[model samples]
Target: MPTPDFVLALREHVGHDLLWMPGVTAFVLDADRQHMLAVRRADTGAWTPVTGIIDPGEEPASAAVREVAEEAGVDCAPLRLVDVRTHPPLTFPNGDHAQFLDLCFVCEHTGGEPYPADGENTEARWFPLEDPPPMNDRFLAQLQIVLADRPEARFRR
Candidate 1:
């Protein structure tokens, strides 16, 4: 996948000084509660929820909404914060090492259908929440926790 122009510039200018910012990811559930919006990432083909790094001056919830719109062409309202996770410091394929604190929000889809927003995603689809495609273990675990009646279960590092 091609890096966004802004991200490429940030890496070039900041080099190792680039920091991992906290981000918010949204699992947008349809009104009927039968489907969840997900994207097929062009880079990895990894099926994941709408996600993006929080802008320097943006709040997590707002980032979630903006990412959903930008990535999936959908408008959403955060229903509740489902999980807050901090991944161990790691490097991306491009050798950028950083730690990410991710706030996963359960969101209600307010408008728009699934449409891949150009470079950000290759495909966007509404998958049955009950039978999501295989995903990373971390995300699958988080989804299980969020789906349970108790949405506040915490995962320890």
Candidate 2:
């Protein structure tokens, strides 16, 4: 993942310490709703739905779409807001600590083949709902919401 300029500026002061950041996750489903794109994140090498940190001043919905585009070279038509949650603080191997407030969305794939579009993700593929690649526990929860077709989104209080 390319560190954004905003984060770089903050790191100058914080220096890998905990930073409260905003993020977006897109559960990009196919038109039939039976498949979705998952990308192997470059940092973790773990397969997850396209996700990225939201830049300062960016809307969550737009960030979600942009993440999918950047990571997977895919266009998405957002279906609805699905869930919002603060991911538990994670400390990187290099000792950078951060926590994310994530806005999750369920989007339909509008165009483009699922391919590695940016260096953030090494691989991208469409997976069937019945047999998704392994994912982190947090992402698995988001996958549940996407698969359940939840009528309403989970909003942060």
**Each model's TM-score?**
0.87, 0.93
Off by over 4 Å in 2: 155-157
Candidate topping TM-score: 2
Encode model 1's per-residue lDDT on 13-132: one tens digit a residue.
Answer: 778554676878788889987888889898888999888888777788999999999999989998888888887888777777668889988899999999997686899989898898
Instruction: Spell out the clash pairs found in candidate 2.
Output: none
In angstroms, give how far residue 126 of model 2 lies from its true place.
0.5
Backbone clashes, each candidate: 0, 0
In model 2, what lDDT does residue 50 have? 88
Query: Quick one: best lDDT, which candidate?
Result: 2
Local error of candidate 1 at 46, Å? 0.9
lDDT of each: 0.82, 0.89
Taking every candidate in turn, the Cα RMSD to the unseen true structure, in Å, is 2.3, 1.5
| Backbone steric clashes in candidate 2, count | 0
